[model samples]
Target chain A: MGRTLTEKVLGRKAGKDVRAGEVVSVSPDYVLSHDNSAAIIKEFRKLGVGRVRAPEKIVIVLDHIVPAADEKYAQNHKSIREFVAEQGIPNFFDINAGVCHQVLPEQGFALPGLVIVGSDSHTPSYGALGAFAAGIGRTETACVWATGEIWLRVPETMRIDLGGRFRAGVFAKDLSLKLIGDRGAEMANYKAVEFAGPAAGELDIGSRLTLANMSAEMGAKNGYFAPDEKAFEWLEGRARRPFAAVASDPDASYESVLACDLDTLEPQVACPHTVDNVKPVAAVAGKPVHQVLIGTCTNGRLEDLEAAARILRGRKVHPSVRVLVVPASWQVYREALASGALAALVEAGCVILNSGCGPCLGAHEGLLAAGEVCVSTSNRNFRGRMGHRDSEIYLVSPATAAATAATGKLTDPREFS
Target chain B: MSRGAVWKYGDDVNTDVIFPGRYTYQIMAPEEMARHALEDLDPAFAKGVKPGDVVVAGKNFGCGSSREQAAACLKAAGVQAVVAKSFARIYFRNAINLGLAVLQSEEAAGALDTGDAVDLDLARGEIRSAKGTFRFLPLPASVLGIIEAGGLIEYTKKRLEREQE
Candidate 1:
């Protein structure tokens, strides 16, 4: 009866041997709240508490609405800034910081073998480095603010084994969309997914970040890939703490096991209105689009920019198409600029925005108009996720997004390759 | 505690439709969010829903962002509870923490229809709608304690006060 990675991490925090199907109160190593900190602060005040239980352990980031979209958002940011200053939360990343997922790790707050929770759903993005991260609501976060602890039901583990080699231009985004397309709503509900097998090792930390971040779309509580050399390599100079590397047992029990052969997977896309409404690029090709967005927490890393630049080099964006490239973090943006990736993109007529969650949550920047069609690399494509509920969104990899921007339609990356 | 009625929906009712992201910036209060509850999915849901009305849906209700507004809007819109075949993990926690009753019963979820009369006994994990009588698994005792305490806020407030005492 070996313990799964989730069981071991949670059980260690709970100070007892635990398993799936049990609810236990566990103190988290790190808790995060973003621009929603404004709303969370409102609830925290109502909890009748004068001070936070563990202010030092909490992180507050401002990436949702930078420079404040309007007066209301500006006020929200102002409120959060005041809360952070008043509460004396040491780990505070303001507007210029970038997305909390990237910032948390870059700033060395997220660590392996820790239980991390955030107010936003994609907080599981930290699991790319083997942390047990999940999302909670603002009110629940308020409770954590007051008490410094939360009770979470240990979720059953779902093992997704990725094997075989990936074809060129078929990155982790394609594999993630295919997995959700084949088994979305039911398989991952209330379950934590452990991505195993050789293919999991094949992906770099950036690709792993994309896979873990979109695990939210599968209804997963969290998704994990065990810490390995790649994880250490990425965290080399950034991580401040010496973490105990954790991995699942060789014979750990799982609720279900799914297999995906990377060799056969193709460039994928999630159609408008649903994360699970996925399709292969060839299946729905030739649909004209008005815009192409090439960044977000999911695919806004330096490697993602490099991949897009590879496809966009010496090619101009279609006259009818609008392409926007946003890096995930300031670090990534700086590196992309230093590495000439930004130059290639700029030469290709792509507009490079600041490093933030641009146009993903529809907070601001690159918003779509009514009836416009957008090919994006963000996580969700729900109605009005960008700007107009009537606008259409197609989820694709950066390679495909760059290819589509060149053609002004849903073009396959292999065609450009 | 009382007999109720249902408003049915099909599978995968996402949070975007439940509480659109467009309102994330504009609306802050629960009542303000309630005004647009399910507006895209059904324009009249906010106005049509009455207090003590139960929402029944198929698989994966509240399946989108970690927006508490999805559950808060429904709670403010007078949805007594939500009974679905299943729920997204994050949404399930949000709904419960917001003090909105949520039950998972495949039999009850598939059986109910729009405008169907229903009755519930949350303590006993029992449901009686126009479709039939069905049973759902009761939440853990600890979870029930939070719900009984009127959600996380009330529960935490009690703990804080008792610790002070």
Candidate 2:
């Protein structure tokens, strides 16, 4: 009768023992929103609250359509700035900060043993740090801002145990794509997924974030890895506050358990229109691509940039393909610059955009045209996601994206390495 | 009883198609968003849908992204409710928070077809059509309370007023 990590976390927040299917009201340590803050502001106004209950608990980052794509967006940004200043909300990142998912962890807000909610579905990306983070709607977020409380149903836990080591040219993105493909997009709907086992432990923080970030694609309420030495080491200097890690009990109950062996895993790609329409890179190799995007909250970390750089060093991109490199945050951008990864990418004819979510959600920067195909390191391949409805997106790892950009087609990363 | 014509779709009808991400930042007004609802998935949906029409789809309806516009647009466009085999977690919450009725019934999703006339009884959790009738689990009282109040904003306002009283 042991409790899972989710049960333990919710129990602490609820001030009582809770079980799956039970709804409890609790105040989250942080509630995040980005460009959608404009809409949230509207909803908050409708609530007629003079001021937010707890401004410190709210985090706003402007990365969706950074620097204002047009007059309308600029007005929205202006309103947000005014609202942030008036409400005395301390945590606010403007256009230069980068994607909210990366900026939250980089600023040390995503701590273990805390509850966090955001207005974006990928808000669960923070669960990689062992926090119980889930995505909520803008209206719910506005309510949280007004009252400082929100209700959540304790979710059933799904345990995914990853074993064995990944071969060269295969990465966390490949494993993530494989899992979604095998289980389909709705595999973990409304459930919490805990990644465990040897391979999960061996993955670096960046890889863990990639897995947790893509968990949204599987419709998971949240996805997380137990905080271990690696997680603690990553948070050592970055974490703003001290936190105690949470872990599941030895006999914690799980709705189901899935065992994934990484030994034979290969580079994988999600084809046009859906994230779960995945195949081995070899199966779809030689499909012509017009663009290659190598950054976003999904694969826009320093390690991902270095992975692409290793492949693109001293090599020019295919003349027909336009390669765009975006860092996840200013911190990652600076680190890549210092490490010469940016130089390698730039020298290889890649367009290095600023640190933000560039073209991942099709808000701005690097949108595809009709009949164009893009090999992207970012997550989500839904139709009309990046640009024209006729344009297609192929989701791949950074190594695979780089290889595809170099060849102007969907090429396996193994060919480059 | 609430009745509407069904607009049928298949599995994984994601938010990107329901309300394209390209308009996520550009459009703010709910009415404006209504113009783009399902424009990518089905161009005729926005123009043809009446105020009481319902959307029927297979598994994972409203999947992808946490944009409330996906539900808000449909609601603005006069979508009475959405019937699906299942729903993505965040979108389910978004739909309720926006006061949009969302029902999950494998029976209803499989039985309903495009252009079918259907009637829904919220009080009894029954969906009746010419083909037959399907029952879905009744929503929890707490969720019903939110919808009854029109949305979370009104619910919160009432709660705040009660606290002050």
Candidate 3:
């Protein structure tokens, strides 16, 4: 079998023959835990792990239920705080630290040629920086917590080749939705998804991150981009240690390869209850919506906000629709505000949520009631995915969502410009 | 011989309702969690579930939340194996790591009713219930190893012992 990006990383880390379905252990460059998953720390106590193998190798971020939405949640953070203090884990991001994946890359914790694991599914969001990031369960999180390593099966790799350039109204979110639709959710199950092609090369790092972040929704184990100049530029300000690069060899073979031509694609949406229910914007053009949200770890970068702002400029939101804009992190929020994107969105009557997963997790804010409809840029819109179990959610590109919010109907962004 | 009482459930049961977000922060013993397992979808889940019963669900069982609490609760509730058509990625890993058996089979999921008595063959990946015998797709070899070793910690200890030996 030819080496895949996932195999190369796991093999080097394991220093052995890594194969699918084999029980092999490999050290990770970083292990991430969050407030919702800090309960693992409490479980770690039961396992009798003395000191964490390496505090520097671990990252703790408090995002979910941050600032303590309830007493139960506050106590959860308190326990994580206690564990971090006891273990002397040096890299700790608290309620004020912003989203974990966002801050990890921002602070130089993620680097190329390293394996990163987090407690959340969206942890794969960091693959844009050319690292292997996989989301594991809490027990696996605990195993990593105690030993700084965990077992993995070297997954078969599937190559997605992007060609041509995106049209004016299309964005990375549309492309991702299109992939999910063409290939069912199970197509990428337990596989490494490598994205390559001329269109992929033209995309910025943030756009690549958007593509890789949702690979989890397709049931992929790892998603990555090859290290390029963009990766170096992303690492410029936050690193001091020199790192070796890892990439697939020229003749690396893939189990399957899919080619996506951007020039032929249009804005797309994933219908209710399934991310794989993909359709073009023209198919759902006149669908009415009750809410429009434009953010998630996938599309919550400053560029996404800028795109939404560009569409919303000089226009007011429809009376029937509520628009919510959430920046993925505090830094992204600062960039948006500095660039006047925030002003445009606010003037257009869009509600700006804090820099965490506010309405994304069906938490305290922006929840939908029964029978209501929402066009959101977030990943996943399953039953009760957004808020109420009965509400319908239409997953769309940020441009489509913004334009729909402005028009109170599922209008195309091209309609405005 | 089967070791305990039977507790049963239907198909397509998800991980979120098994262990809701509200309890994710609480490290209450698995026993405490068992009391709340499936509370959202079925209020009587805690009361009716007994040790050694198999949960037969349709496709995509254990579909949400990376929290192992859902598995911990099932184990604490003493579910011997989860026989389903399919499983979400995180839940399958969590179940094996927690020493809970998850057997996948479309036939097994289709044949078993909520309260049927069943026998599990871990090695063969088959479930024998009153409805009939259904073959479960084998788990990944790594996961099967962990399950046989009685979860992650024990497997680690055994590996260290062998290394020293």
Specify the highest-DockQ model's number.
2
Q: Between candidates 1 and 3, name the one with more favorable DockQ.
A: 1
Summarize candidate 3's per-residue lDDT along B38-113 as a digit string, tens digits.
7656777789888887777766677655778878888898788777777877788888888888788888777667
Q: For each candidate, what's the DockQ?
A: 0.74, 0.89, 0.44
Instruction: For candidate 3, write residues A219-312 as lDDT tens digits.
Output: 7878888878878987998864576778887678788899989999888999977788899988888888999988877778889999999989
Candidate 1 residue-wise lDDT at A188: 90
Return the TM-score for each candidate structure: 0.98, 0.99, 0.91
| DockQ score of the complex predicted as candidate 3 | 0.44
CA RMSD of all predictions: 1.3, 0.9, 3.0
Report how far residue A209 has shifted in candidate 3, in Å. Answer: 0.6
- Highest lDDT among the candidates is held by which one? 2
Q: Rank the candidates by DockQ, best first.
A: 2, 1, 3
What tens-digit string does per-residue lDDT give for candidate 1 at A1-417?
898999999999999999898888999888999888888888899989899999988998888777578899888888888888888888888888888888988887777898999999999889999999999999999999899899998999999999998898899999999999988655698889999898899788888889999888888899999998888888888887788878888888899999889999999999988888889999999999999999888998888999999988898999999899988888888999999999999999999887788888776887888999999999989887888778999999999999999999999999977
Which residue pairs collide in model 2, if any? none
Model 2 stretches with alpha carbons more than 4 Å out: none
- Per-residue alpha-carbon lDDT of model 1 for B1-165, expressed as tens digits? 677678899999988888887777554677888898987788878888888898999999999889899999999988888999998888888888889988999999988888898888887789986567899978767778789899889989999999999
Q: Count the backbone clashes (under 3 Å) in each candidate.
A: 0, 0, 2
The sequence of per-residue lDDT tens digits that candidate 2 reaches over residues A224-312 is 99988898889988999888789898899999999999999999999988999999999999999899999999999999999999999
- A best-first ranking of the candidates according to their TM-score comes to 2, 1, 3
